[model samples]
Target: MAMAKLVVTAVLVEGRSKSEVARDYGVSRRWVITMVQRFLAEGEAGLRPRSRRPRSNSRRTAAAVEDEIVELRKRLTEQGLDAGAATIGWHLGQRHGQAPATATIWRVLTRRGFVVPQPHKRPRSSYLRFVAEQPNERWQADITHWALADGTDAEILNIVDDHSRLLVGSVARSTFRAADVVACFHQAAARHGFPAGLLTDNGAVFTGSYRGGGWVALERELVGLGIRLTHSRPYHPQTCGKVERFHQTLKKRLARQPRAATLDELQTQLDTFRAHYNTARPHRALGRGTPQQAFDTRPKAAPTAAPVTVPAHYRVRRDRLDTTGCVTLRHNSRLHHIGLGRRHAGTRVLVLVHDLHIRVLSEDGELLRELTLNPSRDYQPQPKP
Candidate 1:
């Protein structure tokens, strides 16, 4: 518009020739002449910029197909399912045997006001992701909390195969204990076969080392089954990002359904979601294939067939000395209390355990006591100093 107005002003007000104005403005003479003529005839409206869109587009998406796209977006969004352009296109192709390209679907959505522009988000290309090379190579596990209609809080344990993003297990419980974590692991293992390794955050149910130098039930069970276990660093949840993300997806689906009145009802909802997610839903990360397809596409990884010789358990736990100046450790599911001198009571200490051998260190790094625990006794008595 500014250029058009400038050319018109140069030719009309300055009395410059159209050819000279075109040459000075670096515009084609034909354009300059047309602008001057329009300005003379229409006064000012002709100088305004006009859209260059063609009168009609033969390749435009058909009205009926566009309506179907909008309907799919509404239906999927209402059901709390993914309704992105790729997903909608996949469904269209499946239903009609031919679908518009993803870009065309996006344009249709934008034209229909179904797309909201977000120019501030970080681009997906900026992320660096790590995935397991084979199915069952690593399983990521996490627990999320939800509430029932009665306002009772429940915990859901979710496990996903790192390679396929398959929801190997999802169960709801009133509260999770170390025993519950072990049970869910075995249930999923029985169905999908044992994963070569498991990755999880440093939750007490997953690991006992953080609370004290002890072995939790889940940790012991995995070790006995020849499966390796890995824990994320303290306060770092991204180490188990797969299962963490799965929680968000599951909650979105749950949010769309009627809030469950009981745990059984919630379990039913989870089962339905798992079926659709594994078999029907298209995963953008998996090239529009479902998780079940990806899980079955390649040979699965498993724990080595040879029996694994379990190494001794070793961990360091930070604690405050109790009034009795004692700390506790659990080995082979048995709890043992070790005695430090009464004088050290109320001091901060670190308890380092290597199998049955124990070393208690003060906060200043001074070794307060050291001893080998006796399996036959619950209390490890201190020696005369």
Candidate 2:
């Protein structure tokens, strides 16, 4: 094109032969003449052909519609919603009655000065076995945050039965500390009786103790009840797969109701959800049967929960293991030292078992440590004893 312009200038200025200009610039004689005429009519500006764009946009979304789409995309993106402009367009067609293809929509959006957002994909963790052979066998408990009417965030600690996928009990509280959750757990246990086992992530509330266990007081309490406590592997959410999946359903259903004004109000709604979920909603795991169906079929009959009384058979020795993990036990008029799980212990427990395993229990009948009695019991040498 530049060569054509030069040839055209030559044809008009020095009247240099078109054949000579064309040969020098490698252009046709006819091309040189056309360029010369264009230059004469429109001057140097006419040397280049005009763009095909019209003065006005031919295929533009209405200003109002474009503004609406941009605002919607921005809102969704900021809220961590999925998709960019193309997805926004599809979402519009499916949800809001707009059917523009993703590409056409992109042009409209970009022309309107709306930028496409960099999309995010949440990496999926591995799967877990929340499945159970029967209902009431296992339950998982966890807490999630929601806002109150006053815009204050509150914690909702929930319990869901594993086999039937029933929402057994859930409570709303201000804090997620272990004490608060233990309070909720006790509340649930009192109503439903203790489950076989409870599974939870290693959240501070589930694992640590209110007094000093570093493990939750509830866990120790459960262990005392003979209820096993299973902690999900750290950084491994898949271990709590069922509980986490239930959370998704919960957010959708619970978000429908207005935010509660107080913990009581939240509990009321959660109670309603619990009932609805267990009794009314059909669970796929239950072959599209209601969770209540599965729970009721077995007819557990709610046996009287006998207190786990410490049998008088448990020998209580007063002279206990000091901080050095050396405990003095009197058996047949002899003081013997026993090794606790750790070398250093304060008042360590020692259970006398005939077999190799020595079961140790704390004062509260909780299993403190288990040590196997060696065929060879070491008698520490004392100076000139």
Candidate 3:
């Protein structure tokens, strides 16, 4: 527009030739001549540059359709569900009988300020991703923390299939012990069948190798079931990246809802999320199919034959009786308080454990107490005097 005005002013007011104005402005003589004629006929309005876009676009998406797309994005986001362009396109197809391409939907979202460009982030193609060939081939388990309504912290242990992203289990508790981890694993396996292998971090509840080189309850359970167990390298979380990523998604959804007041309430929320994640929510890695769909699409991998002999854990711990005349010993990943009579307070004893069978012997080699551990009870009762 500015160039057009300059050319027209030079030709009409300064009496410059069209060829001179065209050569000076580096414009075509025909364009300069047209501008001068329009200036004489229509005045300043003629010098305004015209739009290069076509007057009409028959193939453009309707205004109403773009509005629908934006509405769908808002609705999905408010519901704590995925509102990506592909997801919006999927929903639009269901409602309108025809949907714009994912790229078109993305452009619409960007134009509406709903999608921000992330040029600094790494490209998806640059990532080296791995997926199991069959469901239950490998399962990733991890624990994440969340705050309750009262600001108390809670832990959620989640197990997911690496192949299908199927959430096998999601258990909420005030704190998860090693025994709790094994129980959750069994619960999930009962429904989804045992996996060929299990992957987890070096958390104390998952492995004892980091602490005095002993077997945690979960490791023992896996070994007994003939399932291989692998731990992420120290300081390397990418080894269990799948479950770690799931924790983020789970927490994001939980953050959108009312904070739970108790462990039970949190467990209820986790259960609801597990159902939706497994059967309803579409996974981007799974080609926008639900985890359940991908899980059922192929045959499942199962654990091989059980080990010839599941190894028994044995250890000896020495301690003095506390003021309560009790000696505490951990057996099968459970702490047991054994009452040994107040008269024996401050007496030193050697606690020997062979699997569940426990023996307490005084320093003088005199047998003080012997009993098989009852896992269901936290306190082991002494025999009557």
| TM-score of each model, in listed order | 0.76, 0.49, 0.73
Best by lDDT: 1
TM-score of 3: 0.73
Writing each residue's lDDT as its tens digit, candidate 2 over 128-244 gives 344766665778888788888999888888787777676777778788776677677777777766777788887777864222233345654664476666667788877777878
Quote model 2's TM-score: 0.49
Error of 1 at 120 (Å): 5.2
Instruction: List the pairs of residues colliding in candidate 1.
Output: none
Ranking by TM-score: 1, 3, 2
Better of 1 and 2 by TM-score: 1
Judged by TM-score, which candidate is best? 1
Q: Lowest summed-lDDT stretch of 10 residues in model 1?
A: 305-314
Q: Report the error of model 2 at residue 113, Å.
A: 26
lDDT of 1 by residue, 1-385 (tens): 8899998888788999989988988989999989888888998898887899999999888899999999999999999989899999999989999899999999999999999999998786776689999999999999999999999999999999999999999999999999999999989989899998899998889877677456677866765576767788888786787898888888888999999999999999998999999998999889999999999999999975233222456575656778998887787889888888688888866576777787876543467887888988888888975
Candidate 1 yields a Cα-based lDDT of 0.86
In angstroms, give how far residue 192 of model 3 lies from its true place. 0.8
